[model samples]
Target: MDLNQIRNDFPTLQEEVNGKRLAYFDSGASALKPRVVMDRLAQFYEKEYSNVHRGVHYLSQVSTLAFEDVRGKVQTFLNAAREDEIIFTAGTTESINLIAYSYVLPYLGKSDAILISEMEHHSNIVPWQLIAKMNGMDIKVVPVLDNGALDMQAFDNLLTPDVKFVSITHVSNTLGTVNPVKEIIEKAHANGSKVLVDGAQAAPHMTVDMQELGCDFYVFSAHKVFGPTGVGVLYGKFEVLDQVKPWQGGGDMIETVSFEGTTFNVLPHRLEAGTPNIAGVIGFGEALDYLAKIDVNWRYQHELNLLDYAMKGLKEFPQVRVLGTVPGKAAVICFVIDGVHAHDVGSLMDMNGVSVRVGHHCTEPLMKRFKVPATARASISFYNNKEDIDQWLSVFPKIFKFFG
Candidate 1:
């Protein structure tokens, strides 16, 4: 990958923050959009902008084609069996909520249980919690090891015929631990339970094939993959989606509606109710195209290399404590300096022109489990280089002294 060329594509990186060059290290929260993605969005609004799948006019036809084109791209991106299996939703939270409300609520009963892990983000955990509470079902949490990796042995012990569904994150946003999703899915399937892998953190770095992974459902946010916010992808096997009912009701997802009754559309359309984010979806496709051009393995290697470098630097600092030291993890390195609050660390880093994410990272449960208020997260991306790592490392001592 051309690091200089990739960095050049993000115009914001050129600007100075607090009299220093911007060093963005929060790719886990959301990645920086390349010029290609931004330009694609702008071109759509400037040239072909109209409501999709409803009109026969020129712009409408163009917009509809562009929208469906994204489905094809996303289908290829995840290597789904068919384009109809991909459902466009708001984000990972909404996608999981849709599954909970539409599918799980109907299938799960008093004797059923939904299993999740302790390292899951709130997006993956809360929806199931609400669904389990509303229905007569129960929620089970698979324990995490001291190293923050999922306890696969404990998971095996927890699995039973009563487990109706399993929801797990591919890569932890907080701990940076990459779960063994393929093995998890196989075990869940053996017990006749469906599996949903939250790929919000994994999709951006790794190549995900839904067919190969064999998970019943997979979800991720577009913004995290260099696309716009408020857009996401949900991939479910056709047979599974056929069994599940629609979560929302309205415009496009219908075949017939009358005073007495209404019938829904097919696999994907049945789930995508109401008007969609037409422009955002097109931009998402462009982002995927951009990603396709770059070597994914190289990108993964680059990000992981940065993580290792950053981890080594953090280890040399006496006051800093690393969160997790799993063998194979994502580029997310979350830590807390002794005597300094995560918020203060974030603020000081920002002032020093090093952007990093701080706080519980929407994982308050995990924070409470670890007995820390929050941790400052330095997440890397493909575009980042050693200079960005040096920028953050150089400024940490000052932050430690300020809080000390």
Candidate 2:
């Protein structure tokens, strides 16, 4: 897949950190932006900077066209049925919250329950807890097995008629376990429940088709997928999203406003309030364009190869215990070394110019379930190669020596 060319696209990889070459293994938190995306952002701000959707002036019109064109790009990215079904928000957290407040809270009754998993990020879990508490609704959790895969039998048992909605992560940020979201969506639909899939981890690694998955809602952050931060997507089915009320009231989200009353705009804009992230959205379109040039299957297989190589290396160290050993998981390794704190391991790795994420990763519940206070995670991307994994693994000996 032209690995050298791919690495060259990210200028950060060329830089040195602490006199060592940077082995960036933190793609799950946020991916390194490509040169094209950054250049596009600069171009937009320099020449076409203006507030979208109002002015008839040339810059505003240009800005508006460029910004809205991204919505179409996202629609194509997810293979959604309609462009209007895609809503822009701050990030995945905001997207989930918007659904909780705008759709689920208004439609579902107090007695209805929402189902989630132990592996969900805090973004997926907390919003439901907040709304459920306020509305006197119940939240059900599906258990994770010892191997970090979901207990599908338990999921089936929990899919009772009382569950009005289900929210699950497509790929776990901590465990790297790819949940069977398509199957889960089908089951939930059969049982008369809608579903939302958090694709923050999955979208960067794989392709997600809306018509194929048939999820009521799907969300992912642009930064995690080689785009800019402060912008993300919420893909909802048109029939379902059209029925939900607007979560916020402000400038562009309205059809009309008077002292008497105010009416809202159509599908996508109805949900996006105020001045949207114009530059970020335009850059995100460039990111999608960048991704389209690559083959999806090749990317997936390359990441799996990286995962296997890293796992094999980690297995050689008796002190290292890797979490989430399920087959076909994403290219993320969350491991804890014996007798060393995760933060210490992270610091040591950083000194070696091998970046990794350490802590609960906003999945405190998953950490508690796994009986670990925290873990050090190295998440991979298509741009990473065996040399990066070698650098990551080379730090283990130093870690063990320091702890001993």
Candidate 3:
């Protein structure tokens, strides 16, 4: 990938943060939007600004077409079996909550269990906890090994007929571990349990094939994948989505409304209850187009190359301790500088034009499991390169002096 060409597409990459040239390394939290995505959002509101699927006028027709076009692009992107299986939501958190409330709450009971990993983001963890509590179902946790890979042996023991559902994050946002989701899905299915994969981290950094993974549900946010915020994708198997009741009620999601009873609309419309984020959805489609035009393999390799450079530099820091370096890890390096809190290291890095995430990253349970209060995370994307890692390496050593 051409770093100069890619950098030109993201205007924010050149901006100064904290009075220093920005070196953003927080792609895992939320990626920076490309010029195409930004321009698409602007053009959408400027040209086709109207409520979709309700009015019969020209503006509505244009708006509705733009909105549904995103659904088609997303369906193709994930290789979903059908367009009706894709439902849009606010973001990853909302998408997961939708699945939990719509499917898990209604189907699971006292004898059922929801299995998850200790390394999951809060989006993947708390939703199941809430549904399990509401339905009197048990929440089972699969352990993480020392290298931050999910304990496959422990996972095998946990997969039993009692497991009603298994929800696993496709990548650990904190650990950068790429999970073995296809195998996990197959095992879960054998035990008669449905599966959900949170692709919030996976879709942005790597290609995702929903049909091949064969999970019951797969969810991800648009913003994390270089699109606009307030839009997310939730892909479910047709039969599973058919059985789920709509969580929210109102607007175009109804066939007949009455004071006594209301008949809901079809599968996807049943779940999408309200006027959706039309502009954001349109921008999401543009983002997908932008991604498709680029060579994704080259992008992945670029990110991995930067990760390798950063990892090598970080290992040389006498005080630094790198977190999970699993064999099949993605583009993330979460670590803690010795004798200094992660927050302090982040502050020091900022003074030198570096930006990194420093906190629990919404995985409080995983942080506790790792026995660290928090960690400083440097997550790279295609826009980043050896120069960015070199800049970080040049600045990071001062953290010890700044705190000493």
Candidate 4:
């Protein structure tokens, strides 16, 4: 891959911050958008803007075709079996909530339970908790090992017959631990439970095939994948998703409306209610096309090299305590300086124009597991290089000097 060309695609990366070159290290929160995606969004708004599936005008038909085509692109991207199985939501959080309310709450009884890991984001945990509270269902947690890997033995123990559904993150947003989701899916299916994989982190870094993984449901946000925010994709196995009732009622999701009776639409439209994020979805398609041009192996190796370089540099600081040391983990490092708060470290980094995330990162449970209140996370994207790492690390000595 041409590294310079790839970096050039992101206009924000070229700009300066506080008189220093911007070194973005917070990709785990949201990826920097490529110029192609930004231009596509502006183009759609200027030329092709219209409400899809409603009007008979020329712009409406053009917009409808463009919107539906994105659905097909997502289907091919995830290797889903059918095009109608893809549903667009606000983001991964909304997708999980849809499943929790529309599928799980109705299907599972009081005696049933759901299994999730301790490393899950609040988005994955809170929805199930809401449903479980209303229905008296149980929520079981799989522990995280000290090395930031899931405890497979505990997971096995937790995967009981009573566990009717399993929700797990493909990659931990905090620890950057890539879980054994395929194996977990196989085990869950063997125990007669359906599984949902939160692919928000995994989708941006690596390729995901729903058929190969054999997951019942998979979800990821567009912003995390270099697309626009306020748009996300939820891929469900057709057989499983067809059984779910619509969670919200509105214009597009309905087949017919009357005072006495109403009927819902089929597959995708049944789930997508009201006017959707038309411009965001179109830009998301452009982002996917942008990624398709690059060789996956090259991108993967590039980020791995960056991760290794950053880790080696962090090792030089005795006061630095890095969390999630799992081998073969993704390109994220969550660490804490012994004598400094994470917020202070992050603020100091910002003065040097090096952006990083500092906090629980929506995984308070994982933070407590590591015995820290918060951490500074440097999540690497393929766009990043050794120079970004060097600039990020340069702030640590300033942090020490200021704190001491």
Candidate 5:
């Protein structure tokens, strides 16, 4: 693969920081948008902008069609069964909250429990806790091994009939560990429980087929996949979604309204309320198209190659302590120096013209599990090449000197 050609597609790659080219490595937080995605957003706003499904003008008709077309694009992207099963939300955080508030919580009772892993982002953990607290349900945590892999034996012990729902991250944002979600789903189904796979970290790196995985629900964010923010996807099986109660009320999601009674709209519309993020969703569609044409297998190999080089180079330093050394992982790496706060490390790296994420990464519990205050992280993507990793590593040994 011509890595330079791929880098050129992103206009941001041309930018210089601190007199050097910007080596962005914070893709786990949010991916840098491609030129196509940004152009699509501008095109929609300039020519085809309108509030969807609420008007009968030229722009509205065009906008509504384009808006709903995105749902179909997303449906095809994830290999979901039908477009009606896809609902657009703010992002992964809202997607999980929707499941907790609208889908799972209604069916759960006092005797029920929700199962989540130790490596989950706060989005997955907090919503379930909120619903569990309100419904008198218990939350069961699956611990992680020293190497940051899930303790599946403990998971087996925790899986019982009482576990009405199992929500776990498909990839850890902090650890880059790709979990055995398909196995988790099958096991949960065997025990008569529904499963929701958080795909925020997984969607950008690999293929996500809802039908093949057999998870009842799946969620991912657009910004993390080279699309715009304020938009994401929540996919549910139609049969299961038919049982969920509506959480929000407005415009297109209502079938009929009365002074005494009201009826909700069908499948996805019932779940989506208010004026939608029309332009963001439209750009998200093009982002999916961008991903479909690329040789993702090559991208995966390239990323893994960069990761291996980064890991090998990082291990040579005495002060650097790597976190999450699972056998199979994504290109992401998290570590901290001996006496530096993660934020300070990140600042020094910034001065060296490399951008990375630092601190707890919204996984305070995972930080607690590892007994660290925080860690500096370099979250890689296909756009990042070996030079980006080398740029990061070049600054690591000098972090203390730069700070001094």
Candidate 6:
């Protein structure tokens, strides 16, 4: 990918912040939207703004086609089996919640357990907690090593026959460690468990295929992948989704309603209730289309080169300890400056027009394991370059001196 040409696509990258050009290192939080996505959203609202599936009006027909087309786009994006295997929700949190309640809750019992890892975000962890609380099912945790990789030995030991489901984060949002998901899925399947991968981080950085991974279910959020917020995806096998009941009941999700009883809709629509995010879904399609134009591996290598620069530069300062150094790791780098609050570091970086994330990064258990309360993170993205990394790295000396 041409980094210079691609960089020009983002309007936010041109803005000045605090007397300096903006160096956005916070793509892990949410990616900056490109102009094409903005134009698509405006076109939808300006011309074809109407509710979907319920109206026979001309505007509604146009809007419904555009909205449903996104479902196909996502199916192709993830290489899911069929278009109906894709379900839309608010975000990654809701996607996992839908699986927890609809597919998982009903299958759990006192003798059954759900397996997760120490490095999971709150979204992946808390939903299983709710199911465990509701039923008597147990929540088993796979440990993370000192280097921030999942302990495969511990994971192997934890995968007992009682584990009815396994949900794991595909990549550590904080550590950027890419787990061996294919092996994990196979191991879980060997134990008669269905696997759900939290691909919110992996899908954005690298190409993902749900079929080849052999995962029964996979999910990610749109905003993380340069699409609009308020939309996320849940990809389940046809057989798996066939077994799951609807999580919500409302207008479009129902096939028939009576005073006696009500029947739910089919495949994805059953899980997706009420009027969906029409404009946001349309924007998501455009974002995916824009993404398809770029070579994924090229972008990944460029980001990795940026990551190497940051890692080597951080090694120069003895006070700054970077976290999660592993081969085949993604661009996110979490680290801490000794004796300095992460928030202070983040605030100082912001003053230089350098954006970064601070704190436990929604993975408090991982933080507790690492024996730190919080850390400052400079997460790189495809739109970011070495200059952006240098902008943040140059401020580190000032941070250290100020803290001292």
Backbone collision count in every prediction? 0, 0, 0, 0, 0, 0
Model 3: per-residue Cα lDDT over 207-289, one tens digit each: 89888899999999999999998999999999988888888999888989999999999978888888999999999999999
- Candidate 4 RMSD to the correct structure: 0.8
Error of 2 at 360 (Å): 0.6
Q: How far out, in Å, is residue 89 in model 2?
A: 0.5
Question: Comparing candidate 1 with candidate 4, which one achieves the higher lDDT?
Answer: 4
Prediction 4 TM-score vs. true: 0.99
Encode model 6's per-residue lDDT on 1-404: one tens digit a residue. 67888888999999999989899999998999998999999999999999998779999899999999999999989988899999888989999999898888887888899999999999999988988888889999999887888999999999998998999999999999999999999989988999999999998889899889999999999999999999999899999988988788888888899999998888888888888888999999999999999988888888899998888888788988878877778999898888999999999999999999999999999899988999988888899988888888899889878877
User: Candidate 4, clashing residue pairs?
Assistant: none
Cα shift from native, residue 404, model 1 (Å):
3.3
Instruction: Give model 5's clash tally.
Output: 0
Each model's lDDT: 0.91, 0.94, 0.90, 0.94, 0.91, 0.91
lDDT of 4 by residue, 26-105 (tens): 99999999999999988899999898997899999999999999999999889999999999999999999999999999
TM-score of each: 0.98, 0.99, 0.98, 0.99, 0.98, 0.99
Query: Please, what are the lDDT tens digits per residue for candidate 5 over residues 99-177?
Result: 8998888989899998999999999999988888789999999999889899999999999889989999999999988
Give the lowest summed-lDDT range of ten residues in model 2.
129-138
Instruction: Itemize residue pairs with steric clashes in candidate 5.
Output: none
lDDT of 1: 0.91
lDDT score, candidate 2, position 298: 95
- Give the range of the ten consecutive residues with the poorest summed lDDT in model 3: 395-404
